[model samples]
Target: MLLELIEYHWAEDIDEVLLLLGRLDVKTVPLAGGTYLLGLHDDSIESVVDLRDLDLAYISEDARGIHIGAMTTLQQMVDSPLLKELFAGLLARAAKNSSSSRLIRNSATIGGTIATGSASQADLLTALAVLDAEVVVRSGSKTQVDLKGGSYEHPGLALAGVVYKGKHERRIPSGEVQLSRRPAELIIEVVIPRPTLAVGTALMRVSRTPADVSLLHAAALIEIDAHTYRKVHLALGGSNMEPVRLYGVEQMLEGQPVMNPLNSQKLLTILQEGMATFRPPADIRASSSYRRVSGMGLAYRALEEAMNVASWQNVMSSERGS
Candidate 1:
């Protein structure tokens, strides 16, 4: 809980929120869902600027992709018709698997999830990474940052919205970064681009329990041309604070044929080799060795599932044409 002496301020618009954050004497931040704020017992915080009255919660979609409001809750995301229709309901699926309990899902906001920088373990983040999502931030004006490796949490800065791009020729390589626990900024919304072609996405998580934190999580997005992979994106969490991309693995698999089980077997070797250099953190949830070993399994499985999905979709399309 915040200090008894702390001051509460309600903002009706972005201008008012920024003004409060710019104050010199008071340490302030915009409070969205308060899931993260309540967890913070920092004495340094003197006040909180409530964004509830700002009317930021929104979700919209178009040919380009979906636009998600920063204040949208995980539960809301799970219930979004737009998300359910696009990418075979990938965003909704990920949201369903996030933070097990309904109470937390009801309170946790997507903006808070991304802004907190704990996305390395967030199911929603893993899915977003696979989809090449981007976040819009507003300080005084507006700017867009790639969500794959973006962070915001400065005074007067907040995430305005997110953009998911429609599938195009642009290839989003997979990689992960360490996440920061400190609140950096407010996320207003998220945007996901639509794939130019038929793309298959899959999310996999390995946790100690169904409701517990993920020890290893993997997300895969694949587009195939005939028997060859036209594009591939592999993202991971539990190995780092933010989702890490499997660059070497993606490079090796690009344009490769998946008809042969041998191809996936070969990828398993490459994936293990690529991860050998990095050391995963060890804690009570899982030891370093367990995370690495299990993580590799989840990654391989995700890729395989993605390939299978692409194959099925391709077959269905051909059948329709015929």
Candidate 2:
């Protein structure tokens, strides 16, 4: 129980929420799903401004991409048909991997996931990264924070802005999430742009058990031009402090041929060299060397999956055109 609990305010709108947040002391915070907030017994927290009453929950799209409200639950995103079609269900797949229990997923809000920086380990972060997702933050005005190197907190209430790619864009953006100081005051929105090319994306993870967090995981999105890879997006997590894009490896494979089975060995070598600097932790899950080796294997497999999917997509598109 919160021994320091002093007050609970249920805000009706963003304005009221913002006003309440502006008056907060160190002991105050905004509450959303309460999945993460209520579980904490920190003595420093004296009050919680409940945001449930505010109309912050939503799942919509614009010409750019899909926009998910701060209050939107992981279960909501997983059930979104638009999201499934936009990135070939990558978001839904990652959301499923975010939490195993249906009850927990039903209660966890997107804002909470991002504010707590849980995205670092959540498969959703890697999926969003590949889609070039960004966080929309609002205080008095809205500020679009790119996911790459994005970490900020509003002094009072803030809004989330998520900008996604449209169906005609090629380049995917990147972003990052971190633990914030005043998440209650910040409005959080996640935006992900749709890839415009014929691309295939896949997610692969390795863990001690199905319910355990990933120890070494990788995700890939590859755009194919005939048999050549025109564009590649690759990310790896759970093998380091935070998930990171394999920019060097991506560069090497951007224009390379992957349809040939013989290239597998060469591609694996390139991936290993690219991750040569990676130093995974030796823990109960696996040894450091095992994690490193397995991470590379996962990356390679993810790429192969993506390639197969892209090839299928290309063939289907051709059939439709003909």
Candidate 3:
């Protein structure tokens, strides 16, 4: 595909950007970091709406939880004190490990990354999915999309955007759910709710080299009460279009006693059995068989680390009481 001339509009605010995108005559796309769009030589894009001036880059915390603006870069996430302290630094670790290149990390916006809907961003997506992050989008009105929950529906009205939500009764098989967004809609922010219970998280990835894209990755979030699992979230990447939540594995772990050596083997057996049905897409990076096996191992390790963090927190709580 050869590069074609395209009109560039530097928008002063969100309303301007939205207005430009909502135009019916010409095809327009939002530009944040431009990392995702620059690679695409799509001739259909008639105009580019520059969003850098919209004042979307911000990270803040409140009673609701953490709020990260759309234009916030990966490096900002990595350096955030709030992210480093929250959920055992799971988000920070994911952001740091997302790309070995400091330049890429500095330029890659979280919103743009999620917008791409690419499976290659497994590490970050897995972490977000496990954390039940909500994507706030603006079309005409704001809609919050929950990553864990299935698609959002608005009867009679075209959906402006859709995002992940946690804990749905009906599960999508293989946890393959895409963040659906219309061209006219814009993602404004991501919200991660504050955990009510003691929470621990872990992230694991397998790549050929330190900087190489992960062949597979897993992220786990475990909430514990009285040494029993109160809640569990397990997400895997590289097997599907989006990060897959291992609901089967999560269900098995929830309400179960914290993993002990005696029962660890049994749990591992269950985990392996649950993962057997996973069929990762074969690509130049690895075979389907290898990804499947690696997914299982990575999920298990991530779960183990989460449990360890939970246990340590319990011990610290006890010590404080004494």
Candidate 4:
């Protein structure tokens, strides 16, 4: 893999990267771990501004939330106590399945993958979406990261970019539903957080197998009080542009009884309402109709699993006297 014609620049600071970015696209690109980006051998990438020397790979926690330096390796996150304690399922699961191997993870950068934006394997987005993660992109002397933790990056990491400090979902009994096929596959991560009394369900699944991209995905957070649902937040990925929030479905669930898996008929009905609103893109992976239908199914399953986790936690804590 000798990049015979390409020259490598080991940049140490922001200004150094920016200077390189100002240059028009030639055979140039930025490199951190050189995991994915390096795989593509473009004739234009004659010079790679290596960012490994920037010391961007580190994980720290404070009052705000976990601050993951863009350069942090996947193994670092997989082994992080902070990640283990906070976003237990997502970090551990996504790290293993998101890429091809541990060696890749060692070379992969959180910033790199995240900055790629709208990747077929939308792991970090789901993980952050579950926890209401924020993305920080820096340019010039100023920086703007989404405070609401919305998806979509500014595009172009080659210039001067950084994706940093996204939070994880907070777990409360009957709080949010997190659904994925294998806890160890490259499936989307979803979290549905409730406003209060109701349950939130985040549904994520791949239409094809482990090696394929997820055909359907969703995240819905609702509040339930006395079996009555309220303040629902329904968001879907893999359909529409970026991810879409289902306001119509949320409106329907406002006063309805929480459909916690057991009520298949009612759950299906709500899911139907959700499917009706979707106009998913058709591709070789799956047709629009299939993706729409499966998205509903994933939502149903995710809600059920979330409830089970809630129930399990309640029982465990009661027994432990915590």
Which candidate tops TM-score?
3
Q: Model 3, residue 72: what's the lDDT? A: 97
lDDT of model 4, residue 43: 52
lDDT of 2 by residue, 164-235 (tens): 421111221334445333343465577776575477899999887898788877888988787778888888
Mind sharing the TM-score for model 4?
0.66
Candidate 4 residue-wise lDDT, 35-135, digit = tens: 66656555555676777777677777665656677677777778887665442244555555455467877777676665444542544445455445544
Off by over 4 Å in 3: 119-122, 141-179, 239-241
TM-score of each: 0.81, 0.80, 0.85, 0.66
CA lDDT for candidate 2: 0.73
- Worst 10 contiguous positions by lDDT, candidate 2: 165-174
Give the range of the ten consecutive residues with the poorest summed lDDT in model 1: 166-175
lDDT of 3 by residue, 1-322 (tens): 3166368899997877777777889888898887768888788878888888889999999998888998999999999998899899999999888778889888888888777765335378778888888777776434475343334573353444574322211222112324356567777888888874478899888888878778788899988888888989988875344677778888877898876543667768978877767877777777888878778778878888888888777667767878
Clashes of each: 34, 25, 8, 10
Error of 1 at 54 (Å): 2.4
| Top lDDT hit | 3
Query: After best superposition, candidate 1 residue 137: deviation in angstroms?
Result: 0.8
Total clashes for model 3: 8
* lDDT, candidate 3, at 225: 84
